[model samples]
Target chain A: MSSLQLPILWAMLCLYVGAFVLDVYQFFQSNEKVKKAAVIVTVLAVAVNGILVVLRGILIQGLPLNNGFEFGMCFALAIGIIYLILLKKFALSQIGAFIMPISIALSCWLLNLDMSVNPLNPSLRSYWLSFHVTAAVIAYGTFAISFGLAIAYLLREQGKLQKMPEAEVLDEVSYKMVFVGMPFLTIMLITGAVWAEYAWGTFWSWDPKETFALVTWLVYAIYLHIRLMRGWRGKKTAILSIIGFVAVIFTFFGVSYLLPGLHSYIS
Target chain B: MHKFLRSLASLKLAIYLLAAMAGLYAVAAVYGDMEIYSSWMFRLLMAVFWLNLFSCTVLHLPGAWRISRRKAKADFAGSGYENIAQAENCSQDEITAVLKKMGFKMDTAENEQGICIFAQKGKASLFAPHVLHLAILIIIIGAFLVSFAVSGAVICTDGQKVALPSAVAAKIGEGYEIVVEKFETVYDDQGAVDNWVTTLDLTKDGEVVASGQSMVNHPLIYKDLTIYQNSYKYHFLLSLEGVNAEADGVYSLPEDLAVDVSDDLTLIAHGLSDEEVFVHVRYKGEEQTYTLILGEPFAFKDGISMEYGGENNYTILQIKYAQGSKVVFLGFIIACLASVMFWSSRYREIYLRQAKDGAWQGRVYCKSPEIMRKMKEDFETNLRGK
Candidate 1:
């Protein structure tokens, strides 16, 4: 079963790439049919990705969020899932052009990396590993979706001042998405700290990964404060959201690669 | 004092302190000496910094200052008195529209619940920074308490009366002493240790008391203290005997001329001639042959340097003993439990309000859907069933 699932995952990866290209093409054409088709393709890709994860889990006898490669794949899959849910709820199909490419790029990056499978170490035999990493990936995925929404919000705000379609709807959608993502991010941070304590005997050792995650949390906190207390909304809020997401990106990728710590396993 | 008490309880203060602390921690991680900064001290500093920052920021002093400056300019333009007050009192939605005219996008809505606006991003996670800061403080306090006030170690050896360390012994009450009756270890064919067991008797005086066996990973607990088999070492004993072949007289015999040494001896001797004796010495299972003068003793040089290889045939005997030590295992268990709790239990609350029209309408909020879904499903099921 495991062997069979590997090929299916490869096929899913190809479909994601195809959908990403179609979405990029639609971005230039500005045709509703093309855009709708892109959305359908992305949904199909998400379904295939979901099936792949399920099959892999059944074959491995557990959730496949066990190692670094699996973690990367899971994170990409989560981004796809978040995109689908938000796209349906907000009717922000135009942003699909941006999101699909980002998901595909991340997935392709994972596909090209060294994908070695090894048995879990005795220390990782606990159930906490699954709970902690899965939560973190989902949180990251939500943040990625919010990042795309923030970009759209900024563009729509700019378009609106020029007496264009009121981008206020887009702004609201972006704000709502970020609001949803924030609590998840908080949970991720908490779970991560707890898991670290269990595995390494210290809760917050200021390991580079922990440090970056904290920074990302702080950036979002700043954004939230400005929005709620000072009545910051619109383009300025969108800009701050973009900045926070950039920090999130740095935390997720740059820290893992540039700084060697307990999380070196991700590298 | 009333003002101070109110300020102390302010959520704004908490937010400020949390942010400041987070900023300081980031700086400390980058530049400050981690070795000099205790975890507890860092946590405390962080908590204070964030609380103050959040309080100051939330008070909107900076925004008020900007608004006051703008009002001064508007007054200088000779606007009517009532109009100035009205301008100052502009509803949040009108202010949002003005902001939108300035190329800003602000989303505002008014309901009976009062007017509210959400900025384009990160407004929802605004509370996370403070929550994380508080959580970190708790974790640090828990860790500090466990490491300092509640942790101790105990050591025991086989067939020996072992006293607890002075620090721990003082707290262990009055009527208990630990005696290890026998400690043994089993090894595989490849010489790797398979398991170790320590049979211990807890005695008040010298009577046969409460007894238990402790092995690797599985420790024996008595009261608050636990005993674990930590390690073992080998001890050997050797014996040597001597015979005077030259002191013959009437009792002289050929067999009595050379002494017989037991296998326990470090050195063995045989009189090959009147002037010399041949000696066979063993140390750590390796044998060395030596010739000794009639009255002179042979020296064996090693970790244990010996002066005599006996004259006449001698016997050497070797005996081996295994010594084992056990330590209190509670510390390990506590550390594991603390880790599990810290990682798994993240506090999150989801508020869902259904519309009066009997349709499913609500907000889903949580850190991970994996955790949130179970709750969401339960709530949904219960609500639908009703």
Candidate 2:
């Protein structure tokens, strides 16, 4: 890690925390100014996260997505970008109260992880891997946002999050996020299979990572079907969406740590 | 029978099966048992899931097709559009012109009530869900076909030529062999291995058929079969040379291999270094450690000696012939394209009717509120201008 990198990470971490605090203040007081400030802080944190990724990439002479820390930072950046887009397009600032904390947690997690860049594994040195991981970052990032929106929906359903967006809007936004994310997740799975066929001679090996990813996909698939085809909405779909994101989380982190498989190197 | 088909075609059943499958996948993943994927129960579940998806798709197909083909419904009030707008004093031609100006493909139908102008965008997106479903079924079929694929691995040293394993050859074909012309470990500037590259030739009937360098992430494809550079290993051999050289043997070393050297005196290859092979010698009730370097013999007793016999490198190549890979690839391509279409394309419709009072009532069907609002605003603006 470079000298400038650590300081920038620290600054970004602080910015994320600041953004979360601001969002929380806005939630309690219903202040538009605080909401705007939280979005601005989040934008800065995301920008810094991008800079960190670029700097790490330059230092390593490759994408910074090859390791947990770099990918976590990239994931945080994706979350921030998606959150801002939801806020801008859907006027969903209330969900930021749930989202910014996740960004902060990821930032803190990144800070604790090893910052040094290592040589890329021979198996991971492919253009397909870049596409696969990039798609995963986007898909997982949107799922994270949906997770937050689901929580907000549940809270508002219980009448606790009185100032938040209506349960219907939250449900719709969560569904929309999944709608946008499923394709990226599909891309991730396809690109991964293509890469595996080249490197491992088998497209689907039932590796724990692959299985967990498929499970996550299945969960979201269920969410989409129930909500779209059956017209099921509100707390049921919200809970299902939350479960889907939990599956995503497990697929991302738990699989790497607990299960030994083709993707064990990721841990 | 109809009820059974309906049950199979039920969306609720699809959701339940998906949820169950997700649970099974999670269990299989957490249990770290890949055998679960190939188990009979799992296969049965997959078959049922596929059947359900097929039934659902079949049941929904006619409705989807009709929706895709049907022109604008004449009943604007009963059109079931969520966003409704009113435009004053607009002629049927004016509404058509405004809708056309707003980038809608116009289709007009006249009825007893009035003229109904049906404007639509992203019509192809109406079939996006079916595309996704069909793509997944194709993928599942491909996966099923791949279950019978033939695969095997062979290790080859530099300059060694080896035929495909009988198990793989019997399926792919016979008379095919791979010649490892060269094998080298390429290292980056940091001295870490960047790749294990094997330059090889695929030969059939003693004639060269294909030649390429197969490295990690870069497999050599030959017709239906592909060869991958899976892994590499080095064997440190321990050689004994002398009068008692009858105990000489080639053993994979750095792994504790105990050899009975004349019963009482035993030799165990214990470790390895660049210059020497470490061994434990138990002789005459005493254990002694010795480092036997290349070209330097260690005399144990009565002319018995041991030396490092050097290291041999071999590259492990995995050869696979998946029959349904092309089908699977096609499914993947269709799936990715359909996903893009499903997410990026937003189908919108305008059901418009000019009332006898010269006022127009219209309904907009769009999932996105912002887009629907914009379309309605644009329609009203365009109508007022007209």
Candidate 3:
């Protein structure tokens, strides 16, 4: 490992923590300057996180998506980017108080995991690795943002986060995030299936990872139906959004640690 | 009967089935996959979900078509259309040009209210949900067909023609066989296995019909069938001397090669290493272990000896043929396109009505408040020139 790698990672983690703190403080003070500063700090953290991933990829002579730490770093960067996009497009900076913590937690997790890059195994060397894992990163990141929006909705319903966007707007934006994320999630599932067929001799083997991914997709599928078809809104849709993100979390971490399968090597 | 059909076709039932399926999958993830996914109960649930989805799609088809065909009404009564701008005199030519520039399909009609201009875009997205649901139904049918897909594996040396399983052979024809042309393991600079490559030929009637290389991520595909490099195995031949009734023979790894020279004596090739083989000599209830080097005989206490002949490396090739993969791929394409259309595309309608006293009023209709605001901004900016 390079001498500067560990300190760089720690510095990125501290910057994320700083952004998270600024977001929290902005929630109380309702200062536009604090919100802007928080976003800048988040951008800086994400940039550093992205640089670390690229450095690792260069050192390993491959994409840094082979293990938990690499994926976590990518996931954190993706979440930061998605959060910034949501803020820019929807003027949803108020939910950063809820969104920034997820990136912080992921960055902290990355710090603890083994950052050593290993040579790609025979099965891991495939072009599908980029498409499948990239889609997963974006899908999970969007769902994480939706989770934060749903939390803001619930808190607003309880007469908290008074400065945040309206509960109705939060619900709507949360639905929009799902609307955006589901396509990427579908792509992830389809590409994973195609890759598995080439690598494992089956399209759908019902491995724990595949099963949990389906579960996560189905959870979001249900959320979309209730919101779009049944006219569900506010607390009900928010709760469903939260449940879907929980499923995403389980698919990402729980299946790897608790359930050993063909993808156990990823853990 | 009508109520039952309506219930089957209802969104409520679809939501219930989806939630139930999610819960079932969660359980499967926790417990195990094969026991649940291959169960009749799971199949039955999938069948029910399929039926619900099919019925829902069929029932909603006409509605989606109607939505695609319908136009915005000129009347503003009880409509959630907020008036964006008012003008004393608005130019219809400029309005049409602006709406056209904004990508709205233009239509105009004269009603009792006024000269009404209705412009809408992304009307095709109205059917996007139907297409997505239909795509999912197609995928479900494909998955059902894939349950009958057959696969098998066989180990073969170079130029060996291995017969496929009867089930697969029946589908692909019995005259066809897999011939392993060459097999080699590629190593990276770190001395780790980079890949296992197996060049294969599909032969029919003793003539080569197809040829390709199969590796970990690159399977040789022909028609609907594929050949994958699954693994490798080692088989060793042993030369025996100073023993009776057993000569040189071939044996595979993971299983000992045992030769009973006599009732009271037996010789075994226990294991293999880079340049030596572990030979077990069992004589009258007492056993001895000795390393038998290649082409060299090692003698034991009773003058029993064994020699290592050599090893034959075999590549394990997996043959798989999925019947409905094409259908699944088709469904996948449709699903991807439909999902993008359903989510990213926005259906916007601009309603412009001329009020009394030569003034014009306009309202933008959309599901998204952000898009609606943007449309309103565009309208105000464009018509502000008037």
Q: What DockQ does each prediction reach against the true complex?
A: 0.09, 0.73, 0.68
Model 3: DockQ score: 0.68
Answer with 1 or 2, whichever has the higher DockQ. Answer: 2
**For residues A1-267, what per-residue lDDT tens digits would candidate 3 score against the true structure?**
555568879988898889888888877787779888988998898888888888888877887777787788888888888887877877676687788789878877777777776677899989898889988998998999899999999999999878888788888888888888998999899889889978988888888888889998998998888777677889988998999999898888888899988888877
Best by TM-score: 3
TM-score of each: 0.55, 0.86, 0.87
Name the 10 consecutive residues with the lowest summed lDDT in model 2 chain A. A109-118
Q: lDDT tens string, model 3, B182-212? A: 8877889987779999888888888888998
Q: By DockQ, is 1 or 3 better?
A: 3
Stretches of model 3 off by over 4 angstroms after superposition: A1-3, A28-33, B1-5, B69-90, B108-116, B235-311, B353-363
lDDT of each: 0.54, 0.82, 0.81
Backbone-clash count (model 3): 0
Stretches of candidate 2 off by over 4 Å are B1-4, B72-97, B108-116, B235-312, B353-361, B367-374
Instruction: Order candidates by TM-score, high to low.
Output: 3, 2, 1
Please say which candidate is ahead in TM-score: 2 or 3: 3
Which residue pairs in candidate 2 have backbone atoms (N, alpha carbon, C) closer than 3 angstroms, thus clashing? none
Error of 3 at B222 (Å): 2.1
Comparing 2 with 3 on DockQ, the higher-scoring candidate is: 2
Fraction of native Cα-Cα interface contacts (under 8 Å, chains A and B) also present in model 3: 0.76
Looking at model 3, residue B213 earns an lDDT score of 95
